[model samples]
Target: AVESEAEKRDRATREIGKRVMEGWRILDKKCDDCEVPMLTQGKDDDKGECVLCGKGQKKVLTEEERDRAVSEIGRRMLDGWKLEDEDCCEVCDLRMCSKGDKKECVACGPVLPPVNVNLELPPNFDFSDPKALEALLLQVQKKTSTANQVPPTPALSEQKEVDKVNISAPNTPNRYGSNSNNYPNTPSSMQMQYPNTPSAVPVTNEEMSMIGAEQKIREGWTMMSRAYCDCGGPMMRAPNSREAMCVNVHCVNSCY
Candidate 1:
């Protein structure tokens, strides 16, 4: 009874092996006859033309189709062939897709590395009121005003000084030493006088005469004021009368 059971088990095992081999053959044949390129299941997927014979209508695989195929292949390899858990999804594991290579996986979406995404708080932040904003605006205005303030240019200052000098100078012919007629016809035999130094005075006869005339004019003004009337009008007082009268008799009559 033991031998018979052993024999039955052996036969069953062989049959199973044969069936598995046949199944594998069918799968291999299908793969060989497949019009799709090798790694093209996920990568290129231009189809309808036999990969080996180059026959049939061409059709390109969509991204979704490629992803599904890759996932399906990975699932089959993982479950049916008993692959490692890490190898379950080639797309997720390798993160790449390539053309014409059976090992090429589908593209998985880009995976970002773990990072510190939280933002840091700003220093001395206050957003509840307008005081801070107003202060900031004031500071900006001050800076702007300071920047806009332009110092008086040297040229402008010099021009103003020139204007003052021109206005203050007398409008006489020889005011700026241009006309020689204002001085004596003959040059005076005089020397320049320097401060704290012994020097000859350059007074000519013409200048002396002018000085004398100016003194006489002053004396005449003094005498005229004493002999004049008290009414402040330009009227001469009589030599004998203490009371003053205007030269215009009509003015005196009108006043009286």
Candidate 2:
């Protein structure tokens, strides 16, 4: 299909493939003077010398190599280096000189003279002022005193009272108890006692009730047995209970 003039112009301006362009290029010929490959003007102009540097054929870099070279050059430029041109010695191709300064080349003059030096001094620190030294010592002594001084201990109670806790049952398993022999009983004036031992301290009614409750719990009570419903209704035993559930009718089979 024939493209329109504008489309044709756009397509013509677009980049051509390297392979196609290379294939279209006429083969280059080696220049006789430089021995470098020179682009042939035509098939008839195959044998010739280089146009620019007539000594030898210059090797043309591939695209990838050229890109790498450009990247390296850019990296060097970023790191404060650049390619610069300078005039070299036309005769020897290198510029160098000797003696004290730049005038004749190294071939004509003696080298620079040797150089050296020597000196010595004693090292010492000053702290001889009695007033200043005394002040510094006083400051250090004050800091040491402040650090070493112990704070006064605070009183824990107005007066010490012996702990009145009394345990009578040697057979009773309590996690808090640590006795290996028959229990000791100290008759305290404040404690109320049971008739079993007049020598033992008395247990009040509240203590007796607490001990009884603890015993009851140790015998059989469990968290599931104490289950309460979301509505706060007390739990009742379910037959064949696979999981703990509430007793409320409103919460059928719901977990407590």
Candidate 3:
């Protein structure tokens, strides 16, 4: 059986929630500096920076200098941000403040590698299958580390071009929005085409949309029975049963 529109919507919402939780779990073991989710990294303690896109690289404190780290974690927890048990030190196997037997033993080294689970979500899929989603997410960390693999070296010309763009036009409009010189001027006249207008006008429909209308129209357009306020905005809910309202708060005559 095909999923109804309402069923699809509900399933979509649940799928979104599942994906969000996936992302949230990813962040649960993220490196502060690199913003990299150390999916299968052996040790954890806000390690090295990627040095490229890495921002806010937190300083690593020695095992003896962990008092400040505990304080910082405590402060974050107090600020309404939830610090789960898993948020605590994975290697030490201790709470931010707790000084116990290091079961995982940071001093000894990581006994278990970080769980590295990844899922590939398409634009559209049969979200009705929970088992498939679970299977997609069920991934395990490889025992061997691939960190030894070197980053690909770009061609000198390509590198120079990239550096030139970065140095010369660092303030591109796409990067800094309308404040940049690269911003294109917005056209004064543009047709207002709405999606619902076509959806509302079905087979054997008398209404024709003035969508993409280049010039000012005089006639030949049939107005629907749907009433819009004189404010040129759609009529909305009114305080009284007798009154019609213009939803725009800035309107001079909001209620009629």
Candidate 4:
């Protein structure tokens, strides 16, 4: 069905109003270049020119528009903050930062310069002043006196008492009795009790010489017993005498 002329006129008027609103809307790209608001008009031959820059540009915006654009960029940066390459460096074995120009480990990021976090010095640490030195000395003396004055604890005192008791206690005879002999100098008879006699007994020259000979023979036997074959078997004594021999001939020859 054909529309009436009055309806068509009203539609054209509405279209004109929409076009006017669109003309007022700022364009971001053109506004970035211009420091001020721009007047825009649609023409058949060319798009438009920035009133501030006079650069024939299609997009233009005001200061508020520029701020919005910067904010949007910042938001995008925050949202997409990530390492550019998932690929780790072969040498450093760390993820690279996503920033294109980054030269160091991007994911782990470059190590910041070490900050000196040492506490600031007090304004009054002068050592040259005799009064200051005297005050410090007094503090040190007080601390030393306090440490020295800390009495021996109960446990320490008890331990000292125990030690004193042990020192004062009389000596008791061994289980084998005073005259039970072991080495050459030990007494031979447990019952030959003397009231105040010393525990040790003197040995005769002949007895001492015999004991020395026995000890030498024992040591020699021990040395010969320790000799072993390549197969790790012990040396054995030969049939009739004191001489020892490794059973394996090869071991005996090598060992001897």
Candidate 5:
């Protein structure tokens, strides 16, 4: 005999209840249909969900309502309902969980990586220097413009000339004392090779204020706000400070 839709739903509900019982907090609020109490999880108890019906509470859990809340997020995650986002589901206030793409209720399953990708800078990049910034941007533009354009086959003579320029350019010493030949052709690798390169200009008071900001950004500090710096680079809110500051190394007006 085949199972009916109601039976399938009842089975799914039972499975969810069993999972929730392992760690989730049981609430006093009963499901009108099932007559069973609801359950919840999350730091703020922001995820009140019906264990049998999988319906979520639309309103905030009251202080008395949530007095039964427990600290079982660790254990629940270990049971495989990982990557929770509170109140993400539109149909139910239940927490959404999964690894990627399918974000269903805790029992339904899905998750995604955090959306923000950190803005990476090349090693030893001097954002404050006009010349260095110009060079880097121009190199990036050149790479972009050529990436899609297919050139006609170069004649042997032309190819030799290109190779000669490429080879000789590496021997030229940059503002830093070291020859560029020590580095790879890519901007990131080139920067990596010049760890000891001294800044061409002296650091000003404005630039000094921006010092710890970049490290904070790299460490995943949330952006508070943004505006354009005088040099066209973005000035972002400094962590734990009211002022917005530029991340540019060459711009003297780094903060306002």
Candidate 6:
């Protein structure tokens, strides 16, 4: 097939870009707007350019631009940490500097801690879906309602009545007879006697936590049963958020 004018022009442009960036180092980073591969030049890789788009960076970025770039980089990184580029070493052109009175790059001086980024929703989050939005809102409302709720304490008379019932329940006569000793005073026996009534078992702190986690799992808020975190730990979905976190206490990123 004969090459169209537009195709020929695009091919020519790519060829020209290749020649122009022949000696430059190709970076793994891509242009945000063009989605084209970027290349860098100079002794410290300070200069950057897109092969196809001609978008180049020669001068230092402004404070706002630097901050925005750091956020963008953090979002792209799997480590979930943002970098400070305010005083990056000119020698390495990298932001591996210690955040002190005087920032120094580790490659040339000292190590710096990366700032942790906020937990973001999963990549598959869809804001346009009405059902998903409704579910999220409902979860938020449920949590709010639970937090604001205060259990009403029993009055002294009510407590006395409850105590009386508890003391008399065991002595109450049954078809088997009061002194028959046919049943023990165990929970099982009580359950047998009052089969239609619900048991009021006192839940421990640990058991309560487990029950809450199980409830979330039942509501399809967690994927722990089907999927594992990167650290080989069970993953639970964060409340009111699409983010999933490792449930293993020993895992370094468990809190995340």
TM per candidate? 0.13, 0.15, 0.17, 0.17, 0.21, 0.19
| lDDT measured at residue 159 in model 4 versus the true structure, 0 to 100 | 26
Off by over 4 Å in 2: 1-53, 85-256
lDDT of 3: 0.31
lDDT of each: 0.28, 0.30, 0.31, 0.32, 0.39, 0.39
What is the C-alpha local distance difference test score of candidate 5?
0.39
- Report how far off residue 35 is in candidate 6 (Å): 0.2
lDDT of 2 by residue, 1-256 (tens): 8676566333322211111122211124554653334432111132233433433333344554433333332222233333222522222222222223422211111112211111121233123344543454354434433443444222111113323323234454232333322222211321222224333334332233223322322334222333444444333333454554442222324221
For model 3, the superposed segments whose C-alpha errors exceed 4 Å read 1-17, 20-95, 98-118, 139-256
Q: What is the clash tally of candidate 1? A: 0
CA error at residue 63 for candidate 5, angstroms = 18
Compared with the true structure, what per-residue lDDT tens digits does model 5 show for residues 14-43? 554343333344455766676655665431
RMSD of 5: 27.5
In model 4, the clashing pairs are: 27-60, 30-59, 31-61, 84-98, 96-106, 97-106
Sequence-dependent TM-score of model 4: 0.17
**Candidate 2 local Cα displacement, residue 56, angstroms:** 2.7
Model 2 reaches what TM-score against the true structure? Answer: 0.15
